[model samples]
Target: MNPSEMSFYQPDHDAFRVSVREFVQREISPFYLEWEEQHLVDRTAFAAAGAAGVLGTRVEEAYGGGGTDDYRFRFIVAEELASAGAASYSAGLAVQEDIVIPYVMELGSEEQKRRWLPGLTSGNQLGAIAMTEPGAGSDLQGTRTTAVRDGDEWLISGQKTFITNGIQSDTIVVLARTNPDAGSRGFSLFVVEAGDSGFSRGRKLDKIGLVAQDTAELFFEKVRVGRDRLLGEEGNGLRYLMERLPLERLSIAVAALCSAEAAYGWARDYVFERQAFSQDVGDFQTVRFTLAEIETELEVTRAYVEAATLKLNRGSLTAVDAAKAKWWASELQQRVINRSLQLFGGYGYMLEYPIARAYRDARIQTIYGGTTEIMKEIIGRDIAARAKRR
Candidate 1:
């Protein structure tokens, strides 16, 4: 690959990716099936990731991080983790770097940053975003969780489910309605520490895929959140979410595309090894042509995604654009997984195969971070609104 085609990654980035890849291969991949069986990744895995500096690449150096603020660094981590077939690990890391750290960096007080950011960077502290309630999924405006203005504290009462890293999180950035009548304008974000009274996690959720990643229900019953805990200004949570979601969506795209790549690579290898009609399956025109088509499609998708990543780092990426990348890449991922699985025939149907696991994991990409239908709605709305203005 040419230098620009490699994006801004230097020799150091390649080296870092190599280290991460090695870690995943050695530490993560070997134990993934067991972790999935147990329904949660080992707590030590977080500590290990923190010790490796994988958890803190995006955090500033002062906070015990790598001091590399390059978004591409985080992208490399995602790509490597996905390639290793560690979707749960990838998702957990994304929560730390993509969703949680930004709140501390952008809105935290000096003391708050010092208190939390360091532990976060070290993976000693896990973080989760508590925006979706039992009543609200994609619609943040429907949030009913209330945070009442108490003297020096806000009493937060709400329930959030399907929370990634819920069981492991030492802290959560919770979205609660601070102004009852103001609608989306009234919402606010708060950082609730794990030991706080009334901050408790319910049952660990059983999911189809990503089993090693902890998903749980959280309850905030009269949770007393101090003024020091508020993330940004009152009535600004929606704006913050909208602003940061592009990065989150991009992270999802990275995972989806990388997973597709892994699945394709595995299927190609399998075809070459399996014999059919006295020849390797890959030697058959049908199998060889299928792999060729997938490679071309994957490269094209990767290029668009890389361009989107560059735009994001430059701060010029838009929501609709991110939506396009997220949906298209995720959909392409589903296609790749399906075709790869088909190439494996009955073998693909078994969970023992990597393609089987990838097939299960790829289903959620279009559903989370906004659905494909929702993405189209957003892009279409922007188009229609611009036409009307013209």
Candidate 2:
């Protein structure tokens, strides 16, 4: 089924997509290459996105946001961004809307919400979540960033790597170890502002893909914040992370599916227009078969992702299910993009083409969010536990 025909999306969602498409054409397409060369998207793009009413669809209207609880609007944003060949910008926006904002809305106090949500929703400020430390990639328990209580303030000291929006974020949600003796119960979340003393961003990392999205190392050396900056309860941070991970993973899955569809469209158009052997490249039997296989894979994956998205909207999506969607869709994205690029022949290898950029960008989808290996481990553990009960 076409994505618009999916039962979960209403006419309003389709209407929202029209504006998002225009926003991408006007704001992103013109300067995306420049941003890629700079290794960062201009900060103004975020504000423009906010102005277009695409940045804060889930935020409450009271806080200058779209105020809809429905997740379909966010999905539309991802779809349009992917379709526009703006995957790096899409990933960065996903981090802001899907990851950081949800944490604040779900866990932040009323005061906290009032203080931060407006700027976030308005695009005056950008947000990032610091979870992956230099020594910790998939293992949240391995986070080495430490937060110690010092009188009325907490002193945070540690380094985080691979942080999205690290260089430009105005607010950051940092994961720190608060009570080392408490094991899994020890970690906590703290809200650190950009200008806070001793909070500095390291050089933007040179990545293989998604280069326009600023990924950098974040350092917190004796950064002090009052008790008010502590998010939720001190020891519940790990639990908070676990509870919110399903949304994050699902967001990645949505982006993956949309990107794969975009790449396939690009290839399908290219093959039909390019001539080889006195006929269109698509006229060849082998090319036709590849396109057929890709279409089948995408439709099948779409059905699964659509189901998961509905479950998420209903607040019933499990960690295992989201893990399954994330791994499958993301890995499928890499496969589809690679295959599509091959259809472009020599032109695909040239950086001037969107497919070439997509070829590079699609590589990271499988690695981040969580590795496919980690997703399988989560699924396997769940199965083992269920069998034990049975």
Candidate 3:
């Protein structure tokens, strides 16, 4: 499949691409490496992104957002960040745009939207979703976090681990079981404010890759919130998650595709510049063929993801389709980056190299956003159901 053959983006999207590239270069590129060392993005980075008008797409204009519902802008921003070797920053922003923002936009009430959208679009408030627990990874049904109604307020008590944007986030959308016996249907989503007395954060977690992004453990010890905080109707949380999960998986697929492109770009630039035996390393058959294979594989995968992105924007993408995009693209990213690193030999092992950081970060794409195994399960179940109907 060829990218040119697909009618994925228009001229307007291309123009927005340049704006995002400049914004990332001016604001993010300079500070990202330092953030990697400190284990957190600079607090100011979020505000800077807000001011740039690139952070909020699909958010209404009245609330300081871009107003247009185009997701191509989000895709463009991710591609630019990956090109600039800012995969960690890309991951952080994706959580806000792809994971957290949609919950408020789709499931939130008009009052909820009025209260939160401005800060969120302005980047004054960071957001994160707490779904993963210590015991459960892809299995949301096993969630033990409980939220009980106490008159006007709901008391929430549960711990969430591996939460992205944990430390710096101003608003957190938490998942807790409102009814113990209702199984998956019992869970509910709540917006917990940062200053809530009972909410406390564990230490910023240390991870092998994406060091600049904050991953933390969060505990809610009887946190209380009004009924207004609940995202949709009572007992519809799991249904909402099931409906919205395709977007999350598609977001991961977009990142994986961009990561592979960046890794290939690095390898392409390096081989021509480096010399072995007084000749360009890129001139050798082994090096040339490896790079060629990576390019071809990535181009083919790019077409599938491009189509998926269009489907998502049209509201026609299915969970099974998203799972296919997520798993294949992530696995392809890992393979491409690994090969790119191997080509660099010793230099690739160093953390300073862009490829090294990319290599480290690519490991988690398959595991998170519903593990590759879980993605296969989703698709397999769909296949079984279709066959049964026949």
Per-model TM values vs. the true structure:
0.96, 0.98, 0.97
Tens digit per residue, CA lDDT, model 1, 1-390: 222247467788888887887777777888988988888888778778888878888778888888876777777877777767888878888888888988888789898999899988888889898888888999999998889988888999989988989998998999989998887789999999999999899999888888788989999999997899998798998999999889888888988888898899889989989998899999999888999999999989888888888898788889988999999999999999999999998999998887888898788899888999989999999999999998
Q: List, in order, the clash count of every candidate structure.
A: 0, 0, 0
Best by lDDT: 2
Q: Show where candidate 1 strays beyond 4 Å.
A: 1-8
Worst lDDT 10-window in candidate 1? 1-10
Off by over 4 Å in 2: none
Q: Which structure is stronger by TM-score: 2 or 3?
A: 2
- Any runs in candidate 3 off by more than 4 Å, and if so which? 1-7
| Window of ten residues with lowest summed lDDT in model 2 | 1-10
lDDT of 3 at 51: 90
| lDDT by residue for model 2 (1-390), tens | 357877768899888888988999999999999998888999999999899999888899988889888888898888888888898899889999998888888899999999998898878899999999889989999989999999989999999999999999999999999999999999999999999999999999999889899999999999999999999999999999999999999999999999999999999999999998899999999999999999999999988998998899899999999999999999999999999999999999998899999999988888888899999999999999999998
TM-score of 1: 0.96
Query: How far in Å is the alpha carbon of 138 misplaced in model 1?
Result: 1.0
Global Cα lDDT for candidate 2: 0.92
In order, what lDDT does every prediction score? 0.87, 0.92, 0.89
State the lDDT at 253 in candidate 3.
95
